[model samples]
Target: MGQRMKPFIILFLNLLLCQSILAPPPPVDYGDSELSLKDVEQLLELYDYEDGLTIDEPQVEIGTLSPIRHKAAIPEPEHTNIFSAEHELPPQKPLPRLPLPPDALGPQTQRGLPTCLLCTCLITTVYCDDLKLEYVPPLPKNTTHFYGRYNKIKRINKNDFANLNKLKKIDVTASQIAEVDEDAFRELPHLEELVIRENQLRQLPELPSTMTLIDASDNKLGRTAIKNEAFKDMDNLQYLYLADNKLDHIPVPLPHSLRALHLQNNNIQEMHEDTFCNSKDMSYIRKGLEDIRLDGNPINLSKTPNAYMCLLRLPTGRLI
Candidate 1:
């Protein structure tokens, strides 16, 4: 093997000598102490070493390439554009108000509105108080409790509550009502409470038999204003307040169901023994008549010491 390698080594030396002769001179700066770039390249060429392997360059198919494109621009909305100062929507007209239908009754309001528009009407209650009204407004058919307090009403017309059969209570307190027709509340079959206090009434109109409470206090009612038998037929009369008035004597023949009778601050100076208790019937005991106010009257309770004999409690007045 050494003999065969001797000839190849000699051939390599000869090729290197021939290359050194054929190549141009190297740069003068290249030092003889170190190998130069040209010397190394020549040595590699002479050896001709076989490369182990090579990676192939990737090939691209130009025929499958897609063209560049751009999307269409969307138009800007006038109301949504932020770059422009005048981007605003046009003004729209408001809807018109509707008119009332025909067949409406009673007087029109100052603004041509209905009576309910002037007053407030809940389910079955009408509140016409503190409205500065001059007359009673026409109430709804289902009105059960009507309040016309703190108004300027001068009179109570008979037809004010004519066909209102469902009316139960009428409160006209603190008004300027001077006159009430005879039948103002006469036909109201279901009227239970009537409050006409703090008014200018000189006479109380005839009330229905269903009355349970009658408050005519702070008025101008005299002794004759209330009929002697006004409360005789009222079997359900319970509370009667006629205080701060001009009553002269205790109204006689009170109903058996009378529980509270308030006639304070009146002109009452005398009271019979039977005003509250029956002397003829010694067994009669008014157990239900427990509250009676005669405090502010001119009557001397000592004059009729036996007046309240059958009462559950003594009358509240000046006893001495």
Candidate 2:
């Protein structure tokens, strides 16, 4: 009625202005397409959108590293008493063979080595002097004083002092000893000093009344190298050094413990008025018979003036 609804409301407002000007000009945001709810809760808080369904962890190959097992050690029971004493260490006892030294079983040396290793065995004195020694080197049975002087010892064999029972001083002086074995010092029962002086001795063997000093001086002791009552049982004869010997006499019945009777330069001519007194005891006064060395013999002490009464002196040669 106002124009028949005014052209139908103007064709419904021209069909809403042609559907807002043809509909396709709405997409260029330039604000980069618009999200904001804090960018969709920061993109749904950077995606963990769990609606449930995951299953993925298996990548490891940064060149191999996966071996970790461990856990199994428990075995020590071989007899397990821990510490109650197994004690099996007491079987070691085989050690006792050591008894050889008394100077290693004595005697030896002619290069067999052991006379205390070539002479000078001091503990019981064994010198073996001037060792060009031609003999007598086997000594050490507790040899007590034995000086084999200037050796080249020629003969003395009676086992050269057989078993030296503690021989006491036997100086084989100036050796080249011309024979000695009348049992060589007849079994020395502790012989006391027998210096076989300047050797080449003609006799003088059978000795050993435990003689106390009998130096058979410068040898070749003639007159049968004295063996008859040789100082008659030496009664501990004190020093009888037959000087430069080749005696002619005066080895009388001398041992009244004779003091010093060195018959000098022997070949003594004579002397026997009972030799050293006691001429049938004219009150017997041979007081230890003092030093009587008839000088360089060929005697003539005024032809034995009573053979020195009982010697207290006065018998030193040529009293003519």
Candidate 3:
């Protein structure tokens, strides 16, 4: 080898070693949760260099391809792009029309008339309240309840509720009823409630054996208004409200099933020994008579000690 060329070869080898040491390392790939520029700067600041050599933050290329991210598969929506033309939603379907209800009564009947309001509740209840009628409206065959309050009904004929076996409730409040035929309510096999409060009725109709409640308060049910053995057939009678009446005495032999009896504001002055309790049965205890209101009556309640012997609670009346 020529002696002059030896210096040039040594210089060339030294330049190659310097170039290798100064070259930058390859960029690291980060996944989906890649750090931002600030995160990288903080990481660089926290790093303790063994060689004590300071490193400048690497300038990331704007258009470089990011690292491939691995994640769980997600389900696509039904209408992902609702407004997009190709992925647009289909036209909405029109709702089906509902059929009209069956008109049980023919067009000639009194249904939908101005005299009564048909209640769509159980059993097509008929409300004849405030109608100012003199007689009961001809009800449908399947009426469960009849409300004829604030009317001018003077009498209840036998044909009023002739074949209404399904009739359960009859409310003729404040209707100025003067008479009820002996057979007006005798045939209602399922009759439950009879409300004739605030009326001019002198006597109540003969009720069926199926009566559960009877509210004849504020009426003219004088001493003989209630029939002889008025409640003898009502074995299921629970509540009897004859308050605000001219009843000089309680209807005798109240059924054993009576729970509440409201005879307040009456003209009752005394009670027989067997009216509520029997003088014969001392061992009997009338526990079902939990509530009995006679507070506004003319009778002093202390005088009727023997009458209330079988009651669970004494009737409320003027004690003094």
List ranges where model 1 is wrong by over 4 Å: 1-111
- Compared with the true structure, model 1 gives a TM-score of 0.67
lDDT to native, each model: 0.82, 0.74, 0.76
Q: Write the per-residue lDDT of candidate 1 for residues 175-220, one digit (tens) a residue.
A: 8999999999999989999999999999989999999999999999
Candidate 2 per-residue lDDT, tens place, 265-311, comes to: 98888777877876676667777767778799887878656757666
Candidate 2 versus the native: TM-score?
Answer: 0.32
TM-score for each model: 0.67, 0.32, 0.64
Most lDDT-accurate candidate: 1
Q: Pick the candidate with the highest TM-score.
A: 1
Residues 1-320 of candidate 3 have per-residue lDDT tens digits of 34454444334435434544787423323566654435544553565333333322222348968876987788886765546787777999999987744544311224445223332224558776776778887776777888888889889899887787899999898898888888898888899999988888887778888999999988888888887788976889999999888888888778999999998887888878888887898988998988999887778878768888888787777888
The pairs that clash in candidate 2 are none
Residue 191 lDDT in candidate 3: 93
